[model samples]
Target: MTRITAVWTARDDLAAMLAALNVDGDQCRYVGGAVRDALLGIEAADIDIATRLHPEEVMARLETAGLRTVPTGLAHGTVTAVLPNGPVEITTLRRDVATDGRHAEVAFTDDWREDAARRDFTINALFADPATLEVTDYFGGLADLDARLVRFIGDAGARILEDHLRILRYFRFHARFGGAADADALAACTTHADRLKALSRERIARELLLLLGSADPLAAAQLMADCGIWRVILPETAPDGLAQLEILLAREGQTGALPEALLRLAALLPTDPLLADTVAARLRLSKTQRLALGRYATPWPTSGTARQIAAEVQPADSVAPWLLLRAPDAMVSEGLKSLEGWQAPQFPLGGRDILALGVHAGPAVAKVLGEIRQRWIAEDFPEADRVRQIASEVAQSAG
Candidate 1:
C-alpha cells in the first residue's frame, strides 16, 4: 500500500492524458521505471504506462481526448502518447503466449496481475494508479526495491531463457542498483551467459556500455569476467583491462569527471588500435565511437598542452588527456586540468601571407606556410607578430 508520486504525474499535460485514459474508470497507471524511480527518489527520463484498455481503444481515447498518439508497437498492444513532458509508451496489459529467447508473442489481457507476472524483474513490475497515486505491487516489488535487490519475477532461469539478453540485463540492473546481487539471478545469468551470443551485437554493445557507464562498474565487471561472460563476448579483453579500468575510474573520481562508456571501454581493452577497430566492428559500434576507441588505445604524445595535442589530433575531445590517462606517462598533470577555456588556436600565417612575404604562389608558397606553422606550434603558439616573423624567415629560407 505504498503511495508513490512525482511531479511528472501532476503535470498539466499528463493530467489531461490520465483523464482521457481513465474516462472509462481506472484503466491506466504509471508503470515501469517512472514508478520504480519515483520511489527511489531518482528522476526518470522515460514514463511508461500499463493500461487495461485494448490498443485500438487506447489510441481512440487519446485521439478523441486531443492527445497525439503513435503506433509504436500496436501488434504488441503498445501505443506511444506524446505529451509536453515526454512521450509515454502506453502498453495494453498482456501475457506472453510464447517466447523464443528473443521475441515474445503476447496475448492482450485485462489482468494487471498477469501483466506484472510477465515482466522480467520484481522491481520493474511496480505500478501506480494515476487516479489515486497508490503503488500496486503485484509481486514483492516494493520490498525488493527498498532492499535494492533485483530479483526475477517468477524463475530466474525461465526469465533468462525467455530473453537471452536478460543474461546481460541482470548484471546491468545489479550494477545500477549497487546492492548485493541476488545469488539465484547471478547463477542463472552465469549458466546462460553463452546465450548472450544469440543477441544482436548492437544490443550487447549497448548493454555493456550502459553497464560501464555506471557510477562504479568495477565489481560487476569482475563478476562478468568470473562468469566467463567476457571471454565469450570479448575475447580480446586485456588481462589488465579491469585493473586499468579501476585506475581510470579512480582518476575520474579524483578529477570529478563523469564516466564515459567509450573511454571506459578503451580502458578495459588492450591498448591496440587494430584490436580496438576489430572489437568495435564486432560490436557494430558507430564510426565515431570506433575512432575514439582507437585514439584512446593509441597513446597521445606524452608531452604537450591539451590544446596543442588537440590541434594536431583534430577532434581533441576524443583524445582528451584524461581518456589517455592509461598511457605510459599520460601527463597526469595535464589530465588534471579542465578543457573549459581550451580552444585549438588558429595558425596566424597562411599561403597568402607567405606569397605576400615574396614567395611565389605555387608549391613553394604552401611549403613555406607549412614550415611557419610547424615553427609556431614548436614555439608554443606565439602571437601573430611572432608567426609573421617566422613566416618571413621561412619564406626567405625557401627562396
Candidate 2:
C-alpha cells in the first residue's frame, strides 16, 4: 500500500479537475480500472471516479471550474468530464433496482459498497483514492487481481440480467487477465447464451474481433464453445478453422508482428467465397476488410480445377499480377532484399515509336505499349531492338 498524495501524482490535471468540483476527497475516489491496472503496474487506459456528489451537483461544479462537461447519461447518473489526460467518466454511486436481462433500472445512492456490488467482476470493482493512494477492497479484488482471476462481483446470473454483454465480456476479460470460470459464472453464461442475439451485430463484431486478436484467444474461444456461446454468435465458422487458428496463434504472438484479425478470421472460416462474404457482411466488416477476407478464404490454388477455371476466366492482366503477387504469404521482404542489386529498365519504345511503325491511334497503340511493358518486366528490359521485336510480334498478332 503506497501512501501517496494528489500533488505527487502523475494525473495532476485530473486531480485539479476533481478539486475544482469542490468534491470532498473523502467522498470521491479514483476507482475501477485505473486502480486495478496501477496495482498490476500496467498502464491504465481510462479513468473513472466514484463520487458522492449527485449528478447535477457534479455537473455544476465542473462548469464552475471552467471544465467542459457532458451529461453522457444523466438518467443513469453518469457524467463525462473531458480532462487533458483523457475523458473521465464520473458516476454517482448507485445500485440496480430492476433489470430486464439487457439493461438495468438503477437508483442513486451514496454507498461505495453497493456501487461496487453492482459491477461486473471483482477485479473490476476495486477502488482507490488516488490522492491518498489508499485502496478499498470490499470484494477482495486485489487478491483476484494478483491471481489474474476474473471473478464476478456478486451473482453472475443477476449481473448477466443487468447487461448480457457481460457474457462475452467475461471471456474477453479472462483472455486479457487469465482466469477460469467459477462454476456460477460458467453456468450463467451458458444459460444466457441466447441473450447474446439481442446485442447489436456491430457490438458483437467489435467484441469478437478483439477476442480473436488476443494472445490466447483460443482459450476464451474454447470456453465459449464449452459454454455453448459460440453457436449463438458465430455458428458459421468451421471447427477446422478454429484448429488452424490455434496453430497460427502458437507461431505468432500478439505483438506488433501479428496478422490482422480479418486475415486470421479468413483462415478460420470456410473456403467458399460466398460463405466468407456472407459472414463478413453479417459482422458488418468494412468494405476493404471484407475484400481482404475474401482473398484469404480463396487463396492462390496452385493446381486445383478451381485454379485452372479461375485462370481461364481472366481479369485484366496488369492488375491481376499486382494483386496476386502481394498475397499474404508473399515473401515480400526477402524479394525486396533480392532486388537490392537489381535495377529497373526504361522502355525503349513509346506511343510515338509505335505510331512511327504505322500503328494507329486506336486500341492497338495501347495494346502495343502493354506488350512492350510485359516484355520489359519478363526480360529485364534488354536492348531496344529486342523489345521492339516483341512489340512488333504482338502488334502483328493483334492485327
Candidate 3:
C-alpha cells in the first residue's frame, strides 16, 4: 500500500480532528478525491471522510471532542467538522438504493466495499486511514492510478445511466489527469451523448468550461466533438479553431501566463455577433463574459493602417486585438501586433474645456470635443500642444 505523505496529513488541526473522530482507526477513514489526489502526489483541495457512524453519532462525537459541526447534508449522511486548518466533510457509508439518471437515493451502510462500489470511478474509490496511514482499495484503483487510467468503477454504461453528467466527467478527468479515455467509458459516453441535453444549461456550461480549462483539452474536446457530445450542448459551434487554439496555447506558454478560459472558448465559436449573443444567452454568461464574446464576433477593420486600428480599439476591449490577430491575413495580424504598446491616451480636452473656450454647454460643445478627440487619435495621439491647437480650432469653428 502506497502511503500518502502530503502536507494535509501533517497539519495539527487535521490530526486533532482525526484523533477526535477515530475510535481505534476502524470506524473512520479519509475517502474520495482527497485520497486519490494524495496518492497521485497532487495537492488535494478538499478532504473528505467516510465512517460507519450515523450522521447523528458523528455529530455527537465531534461536539463531545469540542469540534464545531455543521449539518451540511444530514439527509445524505454528511456532516462538516470545522477545524483551525479547514473544514473536513465526513459522510456515513452509503449504498445506492435507487438512481434516476440524475439523482440517487442512498441507504446508510457499514460495509466499506458497498461504499466503494457505489462510487463512479476506480481511482476515486480508494480510502485511507488518517491515524494509521493505511490505504485500502476494494477495487484495483492503485493499479489504475499507476497506469493513469480513468475507468468507471463497475459497468461503464450502467454508471453513466445513473447520472448522464458522468459522460462529461469522463472526458474532464482524462484532460486533467493525462490519460487516454477508457475504451468502454468512451463507448458509453458516445452512446449517451444525446442525454447531455437533458442536463441543466448551467450544469453543462460549468462542466464544459472546466474541461476546456484543463491542461490539455484538445484531445478531449476533439473526442467530445467526434462523439456528437458537442452537438447536443453547443450545436451551433464545432471544434473548428483547434489549430488556432494550439498556437494560442503555445504562445501563452512562452509568455508564462495562464491560458484564459474565455479566449479558449472563443476559438470554438463562429465570428458571428448574432450567434455569439445567442450562445451567451443560452449559457447565461456573466455581463463581462458576454461583452468579451461580443467583441470577438464584431468584425474588425481590414485596413492595416495605424489610424484604422486605433479607431477600432477600446480600453475595455483590449483583448479584441489579440483575438483578431489570429486572423488568416498576415498584414492584419502584423498591424495588431504593432499596436501592442499603444494605450488609449486620455483626451486633453473635454466638454467643460470647450465650454470654457467661449463655447456654449450644448450639443455643439459636445460635437467639438468629439471632433478634437478624433483628430488626436487620427494623428497617432500627438503631443499636448498639438491636441490643444486642434481643440481650439474646433471650439472656435463651432462657436
Candidate 4:
C-alpha cells in the first residue's frame, strides 16, 4: 500500500487535537481544500478535519480535553473545535439516508469511505489526519486534484437529484479550478436542469454571482447556457441577451471583476421596471444594490462628452468610476451636476433676503427663492450680486 503524506510541513495544532481525540499515536490529518490546495500550490483558507471517531465521541473527548466545542451542525455530525491556530471543523463520517434535492437526512458512521461518498465532488472528498499529517484518499481525490478535474463520487445525475444546488456548484468549481468541465457531468446537469427551480432564489443568486465573479465567468456562463442550466436558473435571459453579456464579460475580463447584477441583467432584458423589480425581489439584494438596478432600467444620459455631464454625476468621490458608468441612468451624475459645489449660496437670497430686497414674504418670496437657486446651479453660483440679480428678475416676472 502506498502511504499518502500531506504536502504541508507545519501542523502542531492537528497533533494537539489528535492527542485530545485519544487517537494518541494514531493518524489524523488536515483534509479537503487545505490538502488539495497545498498540493496545487494555492493558499488554503480553512482547515477541515475528518476523524474516524463518531460525532458524540469526538465532542465528548474534545470537551474533556478542555477545548471549547460548538455543535455547528450536530445533525450532520460536525463540530467546531476552536483552537489557538483556528477553528477546525471536525465532521464524523456519514452517509446520506435520504435527499429531496434540497436537504438531506444523514446517518453518522465511523467509515471514512461512507463520508467520502457523501461529498459533492471527488476533489473535495479528500481528507488528512492533521496530527501525523497523513492524507486518506478514499475516492482517488488526490489524483483528481492533480488533474484539476471535478467528478462526482459515484453518479452525476444521482448527485444532482440529491442536491439541486450542486448544479450551480458544478459550474462554480469548474470556473475556480480553471479546468474544462467534464462532458458526462455537463450532460447530466443539462438533463436535470428543471430541478434548479426547486432551489431558493437566494441560493441561485448567490451561486450565480460567485460564478460570474470568477476569472473565466464567460466560459462558465456559456457552459451553463449550453448545458440548459442557465435557462432554468434565469428564465428571463434570452440568447441575444447572453451574446451582449459575453461582450460585457469580455470587457471586464482582465481582473478586479465587479458582479454588477443589474448591469449584467440589463444586457439580457430591456430596461423594464418589471424585470428589474422581479429580479431584485427574488434575489433579495441589499438596498444599495436594488437602487442601482432600478437606476439601470430608467432612462439616463449615457451618451455625450464627459464635460457636458455634471462633475457631481461622476461619483461621491468615494465611489468607483466603473460603478457610476454602469448605472442604468446617469441620475447619479445628474444629481451631482445639480448639487455640485453650488447649493443656492446659503439663500443669502432666502425669503428674508427677498423681503429685504423690497419683495413681499408671501408666495412671491418662495418664487424668488426658487429662481435664485436655479440660477445658482445654472450660472455656477457667481456671487450674491448675481443671485440678487436673478431674484429680482423672478420678482418682476411674478409682478
Find the candidate with the highest lDDT and give its number: 1
lDDT of candidates 1 onward, in order: 0.83, 0.73, 0.79, 0.69
Worst 10 residues of 4 by lDDT: 314-323
- Scored against the true structure, residue 377 in model 3 reaches a CA lDDT of 76
Model 4: colliding residue pairs: 28-129, 28-130, 29-128, 29-129, 29-130, 30-130, 296-328, 312-336, 313-333
Error of 3 at 214 (Å): 0.7
The alpha-carbon RMSD values of the candidates against the true structure, listed in the order shown, are 2.0, 5.8, 3.3, 5.4
What TM-score, computed on C-alpha atoms, does each candidate reach? 0.94, 0.79, 0.87, 0.76
- lDDT of candidate 1 over 1-399, digit per residue (tens): 688857787788988998898887989888888999999888888999999999899899999998999999999998999998788899999999999898999999889999999898999999898878899898898989879898999899999998988887888888888488788988888899888888889999998999888888888898888888998888898999999889888887776777898888888888688999999999999988888888888865656666666667745677554344554444654544645557668887666777688888788877777788777887878999888788778777787
lDDT comparison, 3 vs 4, better candidate: 3
Ranking by lDDT: 1, 3, 2, 4
Better of 1 and 2 by TM-score: 1
Q: How do the residues 96-153 of candidate 2 rate in per-residue lDDT, one tens digit apiece?
A: 8998766789999989999999999998887777556888888988778778888887
Give me candidate 1's TM-score against the actual structure: 0.94
Provide the lDDT at 253 for model 2: 45
The total number of steric clashes, by the backbone 3 Å criterion, in model 1 comes to 0
Residues 271-325 of candidate 3 have per-residue lDDT tens digits of 6768878888898888777777766666555544544455546534444344442
Give the runs in model 1 whose Cα sits over 4 Å from its true position: 321-324, 327-330, 336-338, 356-367, 396-399
Native-referenced Cα lDDT, model 1: 0.83
TM-score for candidate 3, please give it: 0.87
